[model samples]
Target chain A: MIKVERLVKAFGRQQVLRGLDLDVATGSITVVIGRSGGGKSVLLRHLIGLLRPDAGRVLVDGADVTRLHGRALDEVRRRYGVVFQGGALFDSMTCAGNVAFPLREKLRLRAAEVATRVEAALTQVGLEGMGSKYPAEVSGGMRKRVAIARALVTEPEIVFFDEPTTGLDPILVNTIHHLILELHRKLRFTAVMVSHEIPEIFEIADTVAMLHEGRIAEVGPPAVIQASPNPVVRQFIRGEPERAEGA
Target chain B: MTERPLPLTLRPLDAIGRWAIAVVEALGRFGTFLGQALGTILTPPFKFWAFVDRIHYIGYRSLLIILLTGGFTGMVLGLQVYFTLVRFGSEAYLGPAVALSLIRELGPVLAALMVTGRAGSALTAEIGIMRITEQIDALTVMALSPIRYLVAPSILAGLVTFPLMTALFDAVGIFGGYLVGVELLGLSQGTYFGEMQSFVDLSDIMTGFWKSLSFGVIVTWVCTYKGFTVGHGAEGVAKATTDAVVLSSVLILVWDYFMGTVLP
Candidate 1:
């Protein structure tokens, strides 16, 4: 389980997160949604310890990850797999090498084992025979899959996806979401994803947390959030103009 | 009412203060990066093959440029020195003058500048691109040290190869000088060779070596830091690469002056 308490973060004069709080139950897919620049990615960055909150705490299974440093921080990070917005594949390496990076760097797996694990992860992402291709050679959707394979190659307990399907077409989006569902079902890893796909992504989310004005405006199952009575939530979901100023 | 600005009397001081702060901040950040990169130079998870691969790329692949510039510089130095020496019937001193300048000053400085233009710019652009693309962040998420995985190998390779490149530059430069002095200017080969052998000291050679070594550190350090901390997008990468090449070249010449004054 992860708990965030009154997370306050600021960039110079711009206070992005102000007294924000949220939670993630163990082994659940929590999809955080928000308007562009509403700090959805910022919150995710904080959760992963990429950006420490200016004030408040991020507790990952009761461990204050922000306070941890050096080897302790590294150990905490190893338990996570993150798929960045751009896939973030090392351009110089082949797809196989990118997938095998964490394993080779952290694990003492044999060459044969590394190759096997890489192949398995690629296969899981439906990219079995494309191991030798570089990130530049693959399409945008395929690179995302490679990123997913790299993320899961370590068999992490948790995976963080930052706008996984944002840039893809509708078909590729469905494919990616289904792939995420298939992998989540098989791997059983806790998933915390930030997505812009509204009605579409609600189908796969176990909990949809709506971030607005730096705090979660509403958080519940998909049906509850869709039917939420809060004006801000309604206006946001319907893509409608505000009914009143500061309502 | 509009708020009043600061008094005009203190405006220049304020601007100066702001400029000073930015410079100090940049220096502090670069120093921290250097310290971190140095710390990881000998730690565990040693990527020996990666280090060697960088050497092959930075050292062996750079031979052609080093040779071309070195040869031209030596030939030019020889021609000019021979002409100047013949004025006072001191044409024989052409060998020692050209040899001393090549081995002591031109070889290390020119070689460093060339490498900075070629390798340093490339390194800065590469790292900057990685930064914009979030590959560095990917490494962090993987529990891997970017300094260890990305920077140490380049720095180590620069250290290992800069001197070798400088030596090659000096050899070609000396030969170029020899051609201009003996073959073109009708100077005796024995006089030219004998003068260089007698006049050039071990300390002169050591001075060039030391300078080139320092140049290697400055180039790699400045370039990598620029790339690692690039701002955002393609414009940022281009700016960082330009800054790296310019700053490294300026620092090399500045440091060379200081070293010349200090070294024997």
Candidate 2:
């Protein structure tokens, strides 16, 4: 449902994505894992036209997402859900209001309809009762779940999670992973999760793409990647403890 | 060891000159921005109540403090001027001198400075906070132009508030002048009123009011631009807020000088 071809993104002199190519298939979970500042977020931002690629193109569905402008661009944005890092919830709003924001802002749905959908999405993320809680009042795990609810509130064709499991406790991480699996089985919507939550991602993500040194080093199923002889692939899958020592 | 400095036309010195030129260019750009914001206010699709609501916040709500400041400033100025003139036994002229200086100069300048402290910093901090938090981005993504929703309301507020603020300052300051002239300094009330009426024309008050109106525009423009253009992170918000206040104050002063020359 999404494609990036020879994407060249740069910040003044330093290039973040040096002619990197990636594709996210329809109704599939594609997890992108990479080192920090390795163009994972840049690539995702390009998908939503938040950060314009210096060159090449990002196609969402069939439209050139990089080329869409104004109302047309916003229309494209409505087609996807984005869960930003740190949740990025509006502090002024409660969890329900946060989820309902896009519905009210973009879809112009009636208040009742918006609330109904928000509750349903919250239930999907196992956050059915925490709707009225403010961001500060909620736990970190709940905030992330609320963010996921906000992302899925639109019932978009695709959902993008910047990092689903980064700050979560083990139990919460497992919950999110199982929720992803459950959502995949039920909704069958396209999901692209950029994460260094390697193990949980392997448990849920059908296709894993590893970005390395400004390009995709490997793209395959979890087992195929596990046995791959590529030094970068092996080291990445070795998880944080070994990698921190390597660093 | 480093060599001597380069000439004005040469690389290093030329860079300083270039930077100076850039600052001037930025000022010109800000002027254009002010013009555009003002133009938008006069054109179609005016949100009338929104303007009134803002004026109520920016002007009426802040009036008490403004009144106190203006009253004290005039009282202080009256005492100083009267006492100084007493040394020459020309204390009666104190009325005309205080009237002219306050109406011609101090009124607008002080009002604008106060607004810079209150509204300009408020606008910058509000928008700057919104910016780093992606609220502005969220607005745009929702098909709301940040310029219309965020900026235009503020510009309208500043425009309406400054003149009203000046009016308050003029009244309070003149009252303070009377308090000092008639009560404290032992000058007659009749003589003080007569001197003020005879010396200060409608044009002098108009000049001060008009100068403040322009100053208000500059204040909102600088603050809104800085807030909307803040870079990522906390430091950027701090820098934007600081730049907004400083730039607004400087613009008010510079425009004050220009009005001094241009207005009657």
Candidate 3:
């Protein structure tokens, strides 16, 4: 389980996260949904230790990740896999090289073992026979798949996806969503994904956290969040103005 | 008595103070990054293969340009010096003049500037693109340090390659001078070669080596630091590349002048 308590983060004068608290249960897919630039990505960065919070403690499995540094922080990070919004696949590397990077860097696996794992991860992402292609040579969807493969190759205990479906068309979005579901079903790693693909993402989410301003306005199961009594939550989910404004 | 604002007429001073602070801050950041890169280089689990690859990239890849620059510079120096020396009845000294100037100054300075324009700009753009594209962040998340994986090899390669390139530049330049002064200008080959051999000293060659070494550090440091701290988006990458090349060129010249006064 991961616990975030009173997370406060500011960039210069702009306070992005203000006393935000969240709990991510073990082996659950917790999808954080918010408006663009509403600190969803910032929160995801903090969770992965990519950005430090100004004031907060992020406890991952009871260890305070924010307090850890150097080798200790690396030890914590080794348990994580992240798929950035842009895929972030190293352009210089082929798909196989990209997937094998973490294994080689962190584990020092033999060449043959690295190859086998790279191939298996590529196959898992439906990218078999495509390992030789560079990230630039691949389509956007294909690059994202390669990124996914790279993320999963390490068999991390936790995975963070940042806007995994941001720029995809509906068909591609559906494909990616299903792919996430399939991977979750197979590995059951704790997943925390920041996305704006509402209603669709709700299908895969075991819990939905709605961030408004810098705090969670509402959080629960999809059905419960769908029926939230909060006006702000309603305004956000409906993507419309409150009807009782005149009163 | 009514109080008067102390800086009402001192706005320029205030602006100057702010500018100084910003410059100092930038310098401190660069120093920190350099220290980090050097520390990573000195630590264990050294990536010798990566260093070798960067040497090829930063040095071997820059050979053609350096050669061309050196050759042209020497030819021009030889032609100009012959004409000027003839008026003073010192035409026999043209070889040493060309050889000495090339060895001590132009070879190291021009080669460094050329490499900065070629390899240094590329390095900056590559790192800046990696920064804006989140590749650096990806490395961090994978438990890799960008300084260790990216900066150290390039820095070490520059340090190792600059003096060697300056030597090559001096050789090629002197040959170009010989071709022009002896072959074309009708000066005896013996006289021209002998003059250069007698006049040029080991200390002059060592001075060129020192200058080129310092130029290498300045170029790589500015370029990599610009790339590593570049802002966001395509505009940021473009700006960083331009800034890296421009700043490194200026700093190389300034450092060369300072080293001229400091080194014998």
Q: What share of the true interface contacts does each candidate keep?
A: 0.76, 0.24, 0.76
Number of the candidate with higher lDDT, 2 or 3:
3
Best by lDDT: 1
Q: Report backbone clashes per prediction.
A: 0, 0, 0
What would the per-residue lDDT of candidate 1 be over residues B183-241, giving only the tens digit for each residue?
Answer: 98788999999988899999999999999999888988999999999988999999999
TM-score of chain A of each: 0.96, 0.93, 0.95
Best by TM-score: 1
Task: Tell me the tens digit of each residue's lDDT in model 1 across A1-247.
Answer: 8898999999997989989989998889999998989999999988888898889898988898878877888888989999999999999999999999888887768889999999999999999999999999999999999999999888899899999997899999999999999999999999999997978878889999999998998999999999999988787788886568677
* Predicted candidate 2, C-alpha RMSD: 4.7
| Model 2 C-alpha lDDT per residue in residues B1-264, reported as the tens digit of each score | 777987656887778889999999977877766675667677656666657766776687778778988999889988999989889988887778777877778888898788778777877888888878766765554444567666788888887788888878877988898898889878998788887788889999889888988987788888999998787788998899998899888888998999899998
TM-score of each: 0.96, 0.83, 0.95
TM-score of chain B of 1: 0.94
Each candidate: chain B TM-score: 0.94, 0.87, 0.93
Supply candidate 2's per-residue lDDT for A181. 80
Ten contiguous residues with the weakest lDDT in model 1 chain A:
A238-247
**Clashes by residue pair, model 3:** none
lDDT of 3 by residue, A155-182 (tens): 8899999999888998888889899899
Better of 2 and 3 by TM-score: 3
Residue A173 lDDT in model 2?
90
Model 3 chain A scores worst on lDDT over the 10 consecutive residues at A238-247
